[model samples]
Target chain A: MVVTIIGIGLIGGSLALSLKETGLAHHIIGVDRSPDNQRQAVALGLIDEPAQDLTEAVQRADLVVVAVPMDAMLTVLPLVLDAATDRQTVIDVGSTKALLLQAVEHHPQRSRFVAVHPMAGTEYSGPSAALPGLFRDKTLVICDAPRSAPDAVARVEAVFGRLAMRLVYMDATAHDLHTAYISHISHITSFALALTVLEKEKEDEQIFALASGGFESTVRLAKSSPDMWVPIFRQNRENVLDVLDEHIHQLQHLRELLHQENYPAVYQQIQQANLIKKILK
Target chain B: MVVTIIGIGLIGGSLALSLKETGLAHHIIGVDRSPDNQRQAVALGLIDEPAQDLTEAVQRADLVVVAVPMDAMLTVLPLVLDAATDRQTVIDVGSTKALLLQAVEHHPQRSRFVAVHPMAGTEYSGPSAALPGLFRDKTLVICDAPRSAPDAVARVEAVFGRLAMRLVYMDATAHDLHTAYISHISHITSFALALTVLEKEKEDEQIFALASGGFESTVRLAKSSPDMWVPIFRQNRENVLDVLDEHIHQLQHLRELLHQENYPAVYQQIQQANLIKKILK
Candidate 1:
């Protein structure tokens, strides 16, 4: 199938690579607003060619993958749907879903678009960061699948399945909520941790040299692009705020336990936290 | 040289492997409170044999490595020193340094002991978690090194140097304070993040299915053993509390910005956090 992937960056570029590697896409057309991204996407072989016009790209492709940032998705999804034919399937690979799904709810071509959040990515970004098997063994969340035509949903499932992703179905609200707890809040904590350590590093220049693997892993997501995350936090504002509040509360509780010299309580809390191993493993 | 490694868990076991790999120790004696650990250490070839008596082990070895948790270090360091001969060198590899250094400040054999914290570890613990080259290319902080005998310091330095660790010299107070920002705070944040997600998962079983690499890395240290962390936190209580306060403050600040829908400020904060890429890479 001929696939048009918009915004040819980390997720889009990785998707292009995966689709091509799996023989799922006969030819991949890249559609990105930035000239640099379009040039890099093609140079990196993440796409067969760069499309100059979004409408023409949508019209010509068997599959349209809207892989733009959250803010851009609000505008681009509607435009993509407008140009999509009945036979074409449109799927958006975005972090947050509620707002994007809401943006095009009443559209005549809404049935063509399937909202997907493939639970995978690295700290790096841009077309140069693209790698094959980025989605292998990772979860692919298909939000509000019933809203999309059955054939469109099946196509998305098949594509991600071929890419070796585990599929989970949820509504847009639950997708945003769960992502806040699992994905979005991790970025917020990482960004905060980096800021915290960097703030301390100014006073002790030697501290950076002491950053070990544990510190690196905890602060890794701080390297994520603001262009991708700011819009995500904005679109999923309420959910992110709720999870952030709970996260802050948990931290404060730990602080209080430590302040009281209640080592037992602190130990208990950590033991509780270790329960994540059951799920994550 | 003969080496006796007490508390043959992650650090001690790895140290045994490194020492054996470098031929720094011809014979490695394992000492641990747990029979299972002693058996595992020998079974895993982390040590040549298990020592039945601490005094005999210290007397026979050219060097004694105290790799116990923080709580054990208080009693174990003095005991090891009590048994150490003038020809023997001792080193305690624990996370916090100020308290341990203070506990042995007046010992007659104080010069025989060196305080070191190798900034390398995983969330996992125990002898089975031991791996070769765990300390390679990682920073090794030597606290209050001047207090140790010149020959003792040289021996300790040579051992870690052979393991390919970069050594940094600092006083105990500075070591504890800096680790609070660079190491301890990372663990606290990771534990808190894991707790927050697990709490949400109680209500939503499918939430964990969406956890991606980002979430896993950010919460990886949460799986750290409580037996290891509770003691470190107790010893470095004040410094950990200070850094934890600042970390929580930063989280709250980000929460406020997101709550107010200040995407520009959020963007700026993330951009600032991205400066870590410079230090981390």
Candidate 2:
């Protein structure tokens, strides 16, 4: 089927490559606000061709994928849905869901728009970051799936299935809340951590020389695009604030334990955190 | 040279394997307070044999590798130094160095001990978690090298160099301080992140289902051994508390920016954090 992917950055470019590799995107059209990204997407072979305008792109495609930043997603999803035909399916792969869904809740073609979060990404961005099989064996969250027409849901599922992604379903509100805890908070922590280290590095030039895999993995998300994350924190502000409050509270708890020289309490706290092993590994 | 690894867990076991792989250890002996770990080390062929005791192991070795937890290092280093001959080098791979170095500073055989932090590790521990090339191409911090006898420093350098690791020098106090910002704080963030998700997951069972690569990488250190970290925090408590305070402050800054709907400030903070790329990559 013909598919058009907007933004043409990391997620969009990667998704385009995955669909093309699986032979699902018979002809891919790219719609990016940045002329540079459009050029890079086509030059990197992430899309079959670049569409000069979104109106023409969505009209010519059987599927339209919205991969813009979360803030832009608030406006873009409704615009894409308004232009979509009953035969065409539109979906967004943005990090936050509830706000985007709410934005298009009153749209006449709301049934044509699906909310999806691929639950995958690297710290890098842009067309050069795209790679085939980016979604292979990864979880793909389809939020508010029931709100869409059955055929639209099925068609999106078929495409993701061809890319070998595991699908999980959740409501838009639940999706936003859960991602705030599991995903959004992670970026905030990484950025804070990188700041902690960088602030220290300014004083001690040798500090970075000491960073190893442990520090690298922990601070890896700090390398993520701010353009992508700022909007997410904005859209999911309440939940992000809730998780941030708890996270700060937990750090304070450890700090108090350390100040009191309560080794046993610190040990027990880490043991409790270790339970995540069962969930992750 | 004959070498002894006092605790055959992640760092120790991996060191033993690297020593053996590099032909640096003519004979490798294991010493652990835990008989179970002793048996596991031998069964895994991490050491030539398990020593009946640390004293005995040190007496028989040309070099002693103290790979115990930070809490135990305070006691273990002095004990190993007391048993070591003038020609026998003693090195502890504890996460914190200031307290460890201070513990053995007045010992008669203090010159025989070297303070080194490999600045490397995975979340997993124990003999089974050991790998032959764990330290390859990683940074090894030699703290207070000038305090160590030239021969002691040289022998320790020879061993880590043979493991294909780069050596960086720093004072014990600086080592603890910098690690508090870079390494130790990362663990605290991960543990806190895990607890935040776990607490939220308790409220919402679907939280982990949406956890993506960013979440996994950020929380990966939550799986690190409490047996290892609690002592590091305890030993470096002051530095850790200091860094933890700064980290909490940064998070609060982001929270306030979000709370005030100051999106530009949040974006700038992340952009500043992104400067870590120069140090890390």
Candidate 3:
């Protein structure tokens, strides 16, 4: 397969590496708005060539992977699919799906595009941060599959399956809602936690000195780039807002429980929270 | 050196193992209110024998290590100090320090007791979860060391230093305050995050299926034992409330940013959050 991966950053570079390692893509073309990123992707062996011509790359490629930030996907995704022919498959590896899918819902080439979100990534980003086998044993949620062409869906499944990802099918709306609970909320909470502690650090000297691995693990997502997350929050605004209301309510309730000298209730609430262990395990 | 470890759970058991491994405790005695924990400690080679009599154990031991829950430490710390001789050094490894330190402030044998919190642990508990190197390279916060006998403080340092722990000194008030920002808030935020997601999962099927390592890391502290954490929160209520208020305020601010579509401001806030990398690293 000849593949063109737009973005040429973390997710794009990683997918390029995985496709090449699995022999799923014989030739990989790198596409990025940044010339430096394109050069880095090629120099790192993530792609066979850097494509200066977007249309030419999409026309010759058997599969086009759009792995750009969510905000950019609103415009970039439709443009990439516009260059798609019936025989050429296009897919997006963005975090949010509903808005991106809706943007190209009426396009004549809609059937050529598949919505794919491989539930994998680290806090790191860029071409240098890419690693092979990132999606192995991870879930690849193929959203709005029924809207895509049969062959396009099949190609997506085959590619992700070759990379050993477990595929989950969901409608775009439900996909956004569930991700708001799992991925989106996690990042927001981490950012808030970091801000809260940083606020305290300004007044306290030894505050961060006492931080341990447990503290670091919980706050690690704070280091995630806002360039990636701010757009996600914007695109999935309604769902993110709904979850944020509940999250803020939960924090306030826990605070009240702690404030009222209700130790047993606080204990019960923590025990209740422990139920997540069953699902997480 | 004859060392008796009270309440052989995760911290206690791990300390016992490290003391034995480092040849710091020539004869380690296990003391627990629960017979099963005593049996587990001895059976797991965490200690040489189980001490059935508290007075006898304290009288014969060269060092007495108190590793009970924070709630129990109020009563047990006074009892241990009452049994303390000038030759025997005592320490309590509770998470919170202010209330515990104040509980025995006027006691006659207060100089014999040192307040030490080895700033390390996992979510798991019990003697079986104990590992030998749990304290290696971890911080050992010594609170109210000045209130204790100079010999007692030195002995505590020597023991933890032998276990390869980095030593830090703080007063009881500052220790609780710092931990509220760095450690305690992380656990509370995690419990709240877990509660928020678990609550959402009830109304939405397949909600947790998208959870990846990122979500798991942020919610990991929810699995911490309530028996251990509830008392710490109750004791450290003031500082926890102060930090919890700021955390909630930050979340609300981020929510409003998303609601208003202020992408630039949201991005800037997260960039500020990324500043935690300096202190965390």
Candidate 4:
């Protein structure tokens, strides 16, 4: 099938590569707002070629993907839906779902839109970071599946299955809330952690030198693109805030234990956290 | 030269395996307070044999490594020091340094004791998790080397160098403080993060399925042994508390952004946090 992916950055470019590599898409077209990314995506062969126009890309495509930043997804989805035919399927690979889902909830071609978030990324972004097996063995969350037509949902599922991704289904609101806790807050913590060390310690050489496995893992996500995350945090504000509050409260609890020199309490806190082992594996 | 690892858990066992594989030591011996670990160390061949006594191991050894829990190191070091000769070298792979260094500060064999903290580990511990190259390309922190005899420092550096690990030097106090920020606080945050999610999230299946890469990375250190971390936090209480306070402050700042729904402020906080990009790479 012909697949057209918008944005043509990390997610969009990688998705195009994965689909073509898995033989799920016969032809891949890229639509990016940045002329530079559009040129780079084509130069890198991430797509067959950059689309001449969005409307033209939508009109000829069997599948259209909205992979723009979370903030831009709302603005782009409606316009894409306006150009889509009944047979054409539109999907968004945005990190936040509720906002984008709401933006297209009442569109006449709402059935054409399938909201999917593949929980896959790296510290790097852009066409340079795109890889052929980026989504393999990762969880792909499909939100508000019922809202989309059966054919569209089935087609997306079949495509993701061929890419060897495990699929989970949830509503848009639940997806946003869960991701805020599980995904969005991590980026914020990592960025803040990097900043904290950067600000408190004047030794930049020390951080680079002494960053052990723990610090490297904790601060790895801080290297992500701010342009991508700023809109994600904006789109999922309430849920992100709730999770952030809980996270801060947890830190405060530990802080109090340290202040009191309560070794036993602190040990218990760590033991309790150790339960994440079951979930992670 | 003969090398003896005093505790055959994560750090010690991995070190033994790497030393053996690289032919860094002619004979490798194991010593552990836990009988199970001793037996496992022998079974896994992490060492040539299990030592019934640390002093017995030290007397025959050219290099003796005390890789016990941080708190135990203070009590154990003096006993090991009493048995070591000027020709023999001692090193402790403890997370905190100030206490370990202070405990042996005035020992007659102070020159024999090298305060080394290898900044590498995993959530799981035990001989089974030991790998041949666990320390390859990892950082090893050596503290208060000037107090150590030139030969002792040279011996420790040679071993770490042979393992292809990067060596960094810092004072005992600075090592503890920097570790509290880079390593210890990450564990506390990770543990607290796990506890917070567990308290709020009840469905085991949902948590298992929905816990994304971000949550896993943020909470990974929670699975570290409480026995190991409790002592590190206690030994480095002041530094741990200091970093914990700063981490809480950063969290609160983000919370305020959320509470105000001040999108611009929240965006700015995240953007500021994103500056960690420069330091990490």
Top candidate when judged by TM-score against the true structure? 1
| Regions of model 2 farther than 4 Å from truth | none
lDDT of each: 0.92, 0.88, 0.91, 0.84
Q: Candidate 1 - CAPRI tier?
A: high
Order of models, best DockQ first: 1, 2, 3, 4
* lDDT digits (tens) for residues B63-163 of candidate 2: 88999888888877787887888878988887888878878878998888888988888999988899889899998999898888998898888888888
Candidates 1 and 2 compared by lDDT, better number: 1
Residue B58 of candidate 4: its Cα lDDT? 90
List ranges where model 3 is wrong by over 4 Å: none
Give a tens-digit lDDT track for model 4, residues A217-249: 888887787778878887888888888888888
True contacts kept of each: 0.93, 0.88, 0.87, 0.67
Worst 10 residues of 4 chain B by lDDT: B203-212
- Please give the lDDT score for candidate 2: 0.88
Q: Residue B211's C-alpha lDDT in candidate 4?
A: 70
Query: Tens digit of lDDT per residue, candidate 4, span B1-281?
Result: 89888878888899998888888887998888888988889898888978887778899999998888888888888999999998789999889888778888889999999999888888888888887788998899999899999989999999899999999999988888888778887887778778877776775346456676677788788889989888988999998888888888887777776677677776676667677666666
Candidate 2 backbone collisions, by pair: none
- lDDT tens digits, residue span B1-281, model 1: 99999999999999999999989999999999999999999989999989879999999999999999999999999999999999899999899998888899999999999999999999999999998999999999998888999999999889899899999999889888889988999999999999998888779897887888999898989999999999999999999999999999999999989888888999999999999999888
Per-candidate DockQ values are 0.91, 0.85, 0.85, 0.69
Error of 1 at B95 (Å): 0.3
- Per-residue lDDT of A1-281 in model 1, one digit per residue for the tens? 99999889899999999899889999999999999999999889999999889899999999999888889999989999999999899998999988888899999999998989899999888999998889999999999988899999988888889888999999999999999998999999999999998898888897776888998899889999999999999998999999999999999999999999999999999999999899777
Q: Residue-wise lDDT of candidate 3 within B1-281, one digit each (tens)?
A: 99998999999999998888888889998899899999888899998989888888988899999999999999998998888889999999888999998899999999999999988999888889898899999899999788999999999988888888889999999999988888899999999999999998888868877989799999988999999999999999999999999999999999998888888899999999999888776
